[model samples]
Target: AGDIKAGRAKATQCAACHGIDGMSKLPEAPNLAGQTEEYLVKALNDFRTGERKNEMMTMMAKTLTDADVANLAAYYHSLGKQ
Candidate 1:
């Protein structure tokens, strides 16, 4: 839970594309809130690892630590049922 809160703090950067609640502002950006943690983690990891390739996401995820990925996954997962 604390990690999720921390993720919220980190999420301000995400808010430029994904809304505060994880809704997307850009048509290309997918909604993230309410997504499963497993899926979110996988997506982020893929972005980080370059398996799933998007220039912006790859760039973003590359800089994020594994803990950051998990925290973000947990936070967005917490938004499930929103």
Candidate 2:
């Protein structure tokens, strides 16, 4: 849960597009809330590594450490997909 809390704090930056809880306010941004941890982690990694190609995501993912990806995934996953 510590990671989740940390993630929530880091996620304030994300709240501009994905809500503080992981829901997205922008139509172009997918909801991060309730997504599976694996998916979130993979997506972040891909963006960071350039396997996925979204201009904004590429920039954002590069700013994340592995820990950030894990924590964010944990936090978003805990929010549940419903």
Candidate 3:
């Protein structure tokens, strides 16, 4: 398991879209809490690299380093679906 403290800190930018606990209020946004780490990492990489295209997500993911991806994935996985 990764460090929750580091994950939380890294997730600060994500709160606006994903919510503080990973439950997104936006119908279009997927709830990431409890999602598999593999999925989260892949999705983020896709967005960052332009394989996936969401303006906001691309912008956000673009700024995340590999460690940030791991930490955020850990935090969301810990939340576990809602």
Residue 46 in candidate 1, Cα distance off native in Å: 0.5
Error of 3 at 4 (Å): 2.5
* Model 1 regions more than 4 Å off: none
Give residue 41's error in model 2 in angstroms: 0.1
User: Can you give the lDDT of residue 2 in candidate 3?
Assistant: 59
Q: What is the alpha-carbon RMSD of candidate 2 to the true structure?
A: 2.0
Angstrom error of the Cα, residue 68, model 2: value is 0.5
| Candidates' C-alpha lDDT | 0.86, 0.87, 0.87
Q: Provide the lDDT at 46 for model 1.
A: 91
Per-residue lDDT of candidate 2, residues 1-82 (tens digit): 2298888888887899999878789899999888888998999999999999998889988889989999898889989944
Error of 2 at 49 (Å): 0.3
Top-down lDDT ranking: 2, 3, 1
What lDDT, from 0 to 1, does candidate 2 have?
A: 0.87
- The lowest-lDDT stretch of 10 consecutive residues in candidate 3 is 1-10
Of the two candidates 1 and 3, the one with more favorable TM-score, higher being better, is 1
